[model samples]
Target chain A: MNSIHDMGGMHGFGRVEREVNEPVFHAPWEGRVMALYRALGFLQFWTIDGGRAAIESLPPQTYLTASYYARWLMGLERSLARSGIVGADEIAAGRSLRPARSHPHIMTASDVANLQRGNFERPTASPARFKPGERVRTLNLNPETHTRLPRYARDKEGLVEAVHGCHVFPDTAAIGAGENPQWLYTVVFTGRQLWGADADPTLSVSIEAFEPYLAPV
Target chain B: MGDDHKHDHEHPDHSQLGEMQARVRALESILTEKGYVDRSTLDLIVDTYETKVGPRNGARIVARSWTDPEFKARLLSDATAAANSLGFPNPVGAHLIAVENTPQTHNLVVCTLCSCYPWEVLGLPPVWYKSAPYRSRAVIEPRAVLAEFGVELPENTRIRVWDSTAETRFLVLPMRPPGTEGWSEQRLADLVTRDSMIGAGLVRGP
Candidate 1:
């Protein structure tokens, strides 16, 4: 997430400041659509036990109605099974573990931005923002929230990295009071920088940091 | 909104997106039978979303990450707003997250819970991304899984796997590979493959 392009323009990354933005209102509906799609996706997990075990695990009659995802899963399995990604014996034995990040379709950057700007409160523009090459530090607080400083990002201080303009505060999102942030940034931290001693000396990593999430070093 | 669908008994969801599409299609069919809504123009919106808008969106994101540090900074903050900040229009999500990758730990994203992704920047995720193997294994044993993809990190590299819940989504800023100095933003954008930005894989050196 180093640059704006990576987020799918202004509308998609869940941020938008229009006075009457549409997503904030329709998000829940979309959330439902998303839920249905996800339910379809989750059934893939049970496919491991093969169709029978999965069907058996569900309520007696639920199988008739709840069979959509499992069927999709089985089809995928059968297709892969023939290719030897998983053999037919595995299907019969119900022991098929496939590769990671391998599925049927992916959401693109634009897809994400389409969800932006439904009901989030916009942050007032603030001139105080970080810039590339400035020094900064991650915050120490950890509440149940949308925090930019991961457990890993915490306790480690690095350069200001890149001040990525602005955005709605994720803290807002966590509290159901999501306010769009006004600016964004990317901070470069060496793996050695984040994890001292054990960190790979030659390896360096950059972290995307939001304005409210950082302070001057 | 009423006649676009012919009411296919199969794939009910295709008809679920309001009757407008179905109605439009129905009208198109009638028009075509009676000579109206030319075949080329009939799928205007559909074609635009698939071919014109989708890839163009990809080009914008790929181009920006390579050229401007300032823009990159804005992106890292509020992913959605950053695009708007730089003048791009509506993207998909209500929330955006930017995950950074470093030498010691590579950042990859997965929605173990769902298909939460930052589509605006990364374009479409490949088919395999939504698979259970990537989501479940990535959080549990990311090192081994990444290895299969040929991205074998050293044992010491602490893999911090993110399981994106429905509320939060993620995008990755892959490290710019070496030896690509003096390249244009378009050139740099070419390296921004779907997986690398998602943390499932990295864009390799040219």
Candidate 2:
């Protein structure tokens, strides 16, 4: 989805403020929210991609107005509601109305180590469709759903620098779709290519792109 | 660096307990009461990133790379192994890639979709890194963004913006300062700022 979260190029948000000696979290609640978010991710309630999709699902006004952890909180609620772990009413009501349903895949403290070593890389039967140095153009698509392809790079031509091994496709996996592992590539584009001739000519940008989003130019 | 001096800031002291904070506390209390989340475990998770793991881990790696040529070679080639060799464990979904800043080119990292940082090394991301302005402007006008951060490069230097779109996370091996040739690793590590590793600032001279 071409949501506001994909704010790659559009401007006028004002100056970037830096906090001196910033802590891991701003507020105590922020930490708790983060911990809960991580806990949800650990339980595999939703893929990281799906979580991102949930955040992007926020309406423009809410997205711009909410704090960082607020987005995380909202996204977590969206995923939990979609997964039937808890509903919006229960969330606002501050307690479960009925007995909790059992989930087989609960993650506990003992599983933290195993979770750390887990890898997202998966094997693929099909060979890569693109190689290094091949010129390609990003497929321009604006689906109203989860996607990893950024809006700025869509339809822009770039050179494949390297073909990363097959990995789970996030666009589909985010929404309860299968892993759908596909070829990933590091594509390099001049800033001019992505922006315009007025952009810094010497500047270049590289992005990791899924095979489905690219085509040989 | 001048910009930083001009932008005199205090530590992120979130002292004022706003309505948002109250709501968050309420949510936490509810989740804890529900048995869905354990408060102690939650604190442990947060503490791991807040105190135990953070930019200091990345600073150690950056310091080593600056002093050791072989480690630098290994880091630029295969960052994961190089990092693990220095006791930097791989985070669950991270694949580290070190992009060195050279005389002619500069590198910066941003996740346009989400704040996908190398948590094992750099800990949780800063607030601005995840904000809309940084995410949008970092790719579009990196020079201006860097300027706002007080990082000014020569006109001829080209900026290479790396958008972390997938699992492959990147860390910028900022150039070793000119006068720090014989500095010890610990001394060098002290000079390594979090923003330098993120390509938003330079290592200050001793």
Per-residue C-alpha lDDT of model 1 across residues B1-206, encoded as one tens digit per residue: 11122122112454343432343233233323423123443233233333333334544554586678777777776766665554544454556666667777677666543344565544434434543345334443455556666677766665655544223456677777888888888777777665576665676768
lDDT of 1 by residue, A1-217 (tens): 1111111111211111112212211222222222222222232322221322222234323322322333333334343343344455544544333332334333333333343323332454777567677778877666533344444555568776444344555545433453556465656565566656764454444455566667788
Clashing pairs in 2: none
Off by over 4 Å in 2: A110-118, B1-18, B88-93
RMSD of 2: 3.6
What lDDT tens digits, residue by residue, belong to model 2 across residues B62-90? 99998889999998888878888876433
> CAPRI verdict on model 2?
acceptable
Cα RMSD to the true fold for all candidates: 17.5, 3.6
lDDT of 2: 0.81
Q: What is the DockQ of each candidate?
A: 0.06, 0.47
